[model samples]
Target: MITDPQGTVLALFLIFCRIGGCVMAMPGFSSARIPMQIRLFMAAALSLAILPVLWDTVYPTVHTSSATYIGFIFSELLIGLMYGMLARLYTLGLQFAASIIGMMIGYSQPGAADIFEDAPESSLSGFITFAGMMILFMMDFHHIVFRALVDSYTAMPFGGVMQMRATLISFTDTLSSTTYIMLRLCSPFLIYGLMFNVAIGFINKLAPQMPVYFISAPYLLLGGLFLFYFSVAALVSQFGQSFASVFIGR
Candidate 1:
């Protein structure tokens, strides 16, 4: 019984390499707020669950040699990272766009520690990022991620070639798609900021003696906040829809 214990362990280890890499890079799951121990456990548990389903595809292809095994592990890790990074890139765009919106609307008064990320983000930026991530979780986004992880073996096959060119293309496409979506999400704020600022400029030109910068800053901040209050539902809803399309379709 268990005549090939070493092979079984090695097979599981290889599976862990890929799943662990994906877990460590995926958004929300990878957030600093989540303990590393939890993430490692999640990856290990996921690998165990997926191993049997992929046993024939993976176990046969695995090698016992230490050097060959190491190579396979790295390659598998790379593929997982590519898949995980695709989603991370999409969410990161929202964070970036939030910052742009805050700055454009004169709301970047101060920065606060982000609940998920290590960087200091404007309060609104941090809020939007957290809300979007929460909405994603409620939508069961991780189920899709894990489903794709399982399917990746079929798409790329176990120990298949890494197709560096296609990976590069994927990376580029994620970046471009992220930029386009973020721009669309924040365009309203951009327009509001521009029109409001221009009107303020005209007022300043008419009454140069009055302290426009001081006078207008409060109004600018107030208007942006008011607009955000009314528009946040639409913004969050549209963002969630777009995220689902990109995450699932990509």
Candidate 2:
């Protein structure tokens, strides 16, 4: 059994392992733009907050060897990483959807540049990725993530069985959901793209020298942008709802 200060410290370390791992892998908190000091501060704060509540359940005994302690730390880190990956995957869904939309609208240039980050995403892809991240912040999705972390202590107490398989299943399920939503989100663009291309094809067949491809470019872009602007609200709402449904297991 764990003793006074020994158990408390051990619990703190374990919880910090998971929290730190999450901070390292999550989006807003894990972004390269965020300072390391801020991330560490948040991790420390969260670990301190959870130490008391989880100590009795998760705290390993001080009598254990250093290797055992290391093992416990690894366990905590794994759990945190799993959760963090889920969040990151959700963010990627927006990028994937944007890529699809870009392709449909003839904007799927492979090497376009952007200022927000190092990635060289197409314009529409970049816009979608930026918008999704913004929506997460605007919707207070981070708070919900924190809440989930807190609740995790209850559902998956420290030192409890990690349920690795179940976690993997959850991760895969999130991936599938993300893919499905992304496809659905870009369905309108896909349809429009098909029709536009078919029409352009017919026109080209009639007047082979009319520069149809060149002229159609501007119309395609304007139409895609207009549709995206109108659909922004719906897209954000669907993502938030999907997030809750998956993370909260609803």
Candidate 3:
């Protein structure tokens, strides 16, 4: 049993490369708030847990020339990254929508955050983004992704050529679908902002001396916040449902 210890270790590492790559880009796990060491440990543990289930299929594939083995490792990492990006990109849509929501609702000022990010966001935007992420986690989105990852080997075997056309189609479809969802979620605010701004513009035109811009700011903020309070639950629930269909559905 111990005769091929090196081979067994190599196989396990190959498995790790895939799972590790996924964890590297997955939400929450990949967030700046989470420590790097913890993510690595989680990936390693999951790989070992998965190794037994995939042993028969994985073990034999690794006994190859060193060059081919390296290629397999790269492919495995690539596949994992592809899956991770599929989930990550969809989740990121919520953040993208948040910025639009904040601007539409007259909350365009940026806020402070403990974690680092490239894009600046308003307080409302940050809150919505954080809330959406929490809801996704509570809905077990990660569980769905990981389960799909396990089943991927069946659909896409190791040491096999990657399906470029199919992969590109899926990636493109996900991008388009995510954008549609983001816009749909923010459409109400867009309409509200447009109508409110138009009405304010007319008032200013009617009374040239009136400070309509300053006068309407408070009302805009209040109405937007009120709308958010009433509709946030529905928005998050819809997001969860749509996300499940995207990754978990056939």
Candidate 4:
């Protein structure tokens, strides 16, 4: 049986390894603006908080060799990073869809205008990024994310087997699903872009001299924006469901 102090410290170290790795890549904690010291403290605090609950299962013989210890830490860090990146990738689908839709609508033009920030938006890409972030916060998706983080300990135990091949397959499938989701989410705008452009082509053939392309721009923008606004609620609902399914692995 392990002594209380040794087991406690070991568990804390392992948990913190995971937490630190995760915070380094996870979206909310991994923002470029957050100070490294703050992130380190937060990870340490989380590890400390969870140590008692995990102490029963986390005991492992300490490696005397420096190389072995480094290997263990690296493996644990890799596992944590994998989970964090998965979560971040899943959430990014919304932003990707928004960008695609905006681009199709011609709102993705570079330096056309600025919305939430001073940086110019190409076609409403900036707006999409901003809106996606807002929706994430407003929906309280972070709570689910925290829950997923806690559950990751159970799913992937400290010093667990790597299962690299399976992980690669799972990661690939997740990425594929993300791409499909983005395409499907933005399909309305794609269709609108196609039809609007086709109509413009016919008008150009008929008028020969008129600036049909310029005239078509307003209609495309209006149609795309109308579609986006009308579908925003449904799109968010779909995204929330998809997000939950992706992270919680339903």
Query: TM-score winner among the candidates?
Result: 1
Candidate 1, poorest ten consecutive residues by summed lDDT: 241-250
Q: What is candidate 2's local distance difference test score? A: 0.78
TM-score of each: 0.95, 0.87, 0.94, 0.84
Scored by lDDT, model 4 comes in at 0.72
Q: Would you list the C-alpha lDDT of every candidate in the order shown?
A: 0.85, 0.78, 0.85, 0.72
Candidate 3 vs candidate 4, lDDT winner: 3
Better of 1 and 4 by lDDT: 1
Q: Looking at candidate 1, what is the lDDT of residue 114?
A: 88
Instruction: Mark the regions of model 2 whose C-alpha exceeds 4 Å error after superposition.
Output: 1-3, 60-63, 108-117
> What is the C-alpha lDDT profile of model 3 across 1-250, one tens digit per residue?
5678988899999899889989988877888878889999999999999998999889998789999999999999988888888898888898888878888788857566623254556677777777888888888999988988899898889789778887898788888888999899989989999999999999999998999978999899889988888888888888888997776543
lDDT by residue for model 2 (8-96), tens: 77667788898998888887688767789999999999989877776666654545788877877877788888778888888878777
Candidate 4 lowest-lDDT run of ten: 112-121
Per-residue lDDT value at 135 in model 3: 86
The candidate with the higher lDDT, 1 or 2, is: 1
